[model samples]
Target: MSLQVPRNGKVCVIGSGVAGLTFSYLLNQLRPDVHIDIYEKQERSGGWLNSHHREVNGSKVMLERGPRTLRGKSDGSIVMIDIMRRLGQLSQVQYVGKKSQANRQFLLNGQGRLVEVPKNWTQFAKFVMDPISGGLVRGMAHDLLHCKRLDRKTYEDESVGQLLARRFGSTEIGDRIISGIYHGIYAGDMNEMSSLHTGRRFVEDEMKYGSFVRGMFSGLGAKPSEILSGELMEYNRSIGGQTQHNWTEFARRVKQSAMLGFAGGLEQYPLALRAYLEKQQQVRLRLGQAVASVLPGTGQNVVVNGVHYDHVRSTLNPSAMAAIFPEIQGLQHGDFKSVSVYIMNVYVPGTNLIRDAIAGFGYLVPQRSSQGDGLLGVIFDSVVERNYLNWQTQLPRHQDDCTKMTLMVGGHYLNKGLHLDLHKCLGHVSNHLGVDLAAYNPVTQNLLARDGIPVFDVGFDKKAARVVEECTRLYAGHVTLGGVGFARGPGVPDVVMHELAAVLHA
Candidate 1:
């Protein structure tokens, strides 16, 4: 059946990430009469916010092999919360107040001992007073607290490592911490990464206050309640304790809403948006129908599928579609590479291995330590969030059957060959947890693509600008691009929504 809009024009949207889904939802809400069709190559939705549960050794355990948590305080998180509220799922969103065990985080030094991160003034003093580590810590603290600002134009182009080393002076402690953070976040090497892109917050904070320590102290003193209730405090504690939080419960809550789904991992979010549009009477969705080429068309009629598709009457962007159309010549396609990531969700039975809800958000494997067979990090699901626990009690007993453990393995930056060997990786993780996996019934393994994560090289902004300019020239007013690759993090949906809204209105 051919779908028709009452008065609003017809529109087509491409892709199905959070950016795509949020864009479509906003547009539909704004103009319910507007005909909107969303197309996706995948069949399901919820991009990286995917979760799975299975019976492992007679216990009903949940596992998240992908993004297991959302930054509760991020702008993207705000949008997600609003969306959930609109969908009547906000009540399901629960927060587990500060838990002590979640504070433990460790840095795996060359010696293999997990060095706990400093949590309080006492820990900090101890770390600095140690003769062997004191100089590096002091140097880093001084640099992070007092680095001079550079011109904005040059700031974006600098590598994170260079900026840190310059501000703090290259010391073993500083370098190791920087490398660990880089590994944890981007799964990329710190030395080669653009500081302006990845460490913008740190750099900007330092630029504004002249020191991380000062900024932290100032922030703590001013907004004690907000800061204490937020993830920063949890992160600080993790650093001090030398442990990471498991993100499974957090990820599950995000996906539970009908407005959110993850049929095929995180990639499903975009795909689901496409499906919703296709189901609408005012929308049409096309798939496996790559545009072969695009050419200038005049008046209201442009030939598509051997029939003239009205341009003026339709709300869809003809120019945008033409630009991305496969057949279009003379335009540079965006550079992209397929990345394969391996995930292992391990369930550890018989032990209250994780006590704090925040302790298991998981840890990143530094690039420097990539040579070893060790898994990237382990997330204690049951401990990170109480929502994942089967009981209402604060702590699960060691003999309780409900307790489980989840571990995530190699990422795109890691060697892909190593990931295929799940058994080996599982064994390594079991060793790290001081437990045996054989006791667990079903261990879940998933592999997924990390597509559209922008690679900010030396001149990434220029390259991105050129792509935008070319898109504008070729597609004109038709195609629209939105996603993290365009902008990073939770802020992306807002930026894309505003830009697209302006474009639509114009």
Candidate 2:
């Protein structure tokens, strides 16, 4: 479907998350004549990009209740870097140091002890032989040699758990490793989340190339970089980043290791974008203003908050988006699977608790393990970015080595309705990591995010496609829906790329 760009028409964009903001930025750059007005329900922008930085007593601490890091080593990540440069915020990007321990992450074994996850061949062998691994190595061997592909045709989907158990010859491996990764990102149950969403590219390789092991080498066939380069050029032009692009710069940026974040935190991006957009005469930001309803007319005109616009773009979640436009049909609640999550922030005055405990980027607890408080994972913020703890304005001697951590709670565990109190969470941390909270006089904050993350349940792709199609058919040339949740994958960079492509192509 071809979308006709209006010469000088007004457009209303719902939701002020990264998707909406990036789309607005690109649309404004691509067609400066088009008047853009963004309406955000929240008093502040950055939906899940929440970052809290403050000083308590003499210590500086930062609490990232939402997204914390931006990956800088992939094609999607390069899209974000290009956008940052275009916005003149490239200098603000800070990469994790080359030799930093932040590059490492741990996993909780069945014994409730944190163990460094394998990194290289030697580590992998040791990890496999370890008694704590619980036969995962054997499972991998069976999967690599004997497992056959499922009989599903194109467009058919299966749960991550189903796919793993069928191909890997054991449900234990899925519960241990696969579940932890998905839980960390999507806060989803492997038994329900779609394999298509989690590992679609790899699974597609196995279908055609015979095995996932072989697919890793020959998956993209030949000249895969050629396919990626063409897309990158188109995206670069769409965002006004490069008039004449250099493949060398793109390759260098994509190879850069470590994740990047702003000094203030991830929210800096949206906050800066908001500051930038406020100066534009053609852009209007309506903060704290909710779109009461969306009334689509026969043609290209759509009514939002009693104002008529040529086109409306929705960045809201599936259910919330559907609720606003009651006139549309064929949309249902089951079309989207969103999971609620709770974040507990903790700051201890001394590093004894963290240093003496698990090292690296903290650990993830699998569902099969019995870690009290229903903890999913823990991020060692202080270890990840030690500089965040060193405040410039503070007195020199005031800089004390402190441990700051963000503990993730709930997800599928929310169904249990366990005690989510700060005290209880602290106890869980103490028990799991053997950290003495009382010694450090810990400060804590609880953030409850209801329907915070979108889960890619089985057949989610089909449902997502239907939702988009329904919106198009019901409100042709009137409403365009786009966001991270609707992207092919749910990484921050993935969402940015998806929105950029969708909005530009639209």
Worst 10 residues of 1 by lDDT: 310-319
lDDT of 2 by residue, 70-184 (tens): 7656566677666666677865666664345777778777776777787666877877765457758677577678745545474378888887787667888877766787778
What are the lDDT figures for the candidates, one per model?
Answer: 0.48, 0.73
Report the number of the highest-lDDT candidate: 2
Q: Cα miss at 249, model 1 (Å)?
A: 24
Error of model 2, residue 6, in angstroms: 1.1
Local accuracy of candidate 1 as per-residue lDDT tens digits, 226-268: 2222332332232212222423334334333212212222333
Backbone atom clashes (below 3 Å) for every candidate: 48, 0
Clash tally for model 2 = 0
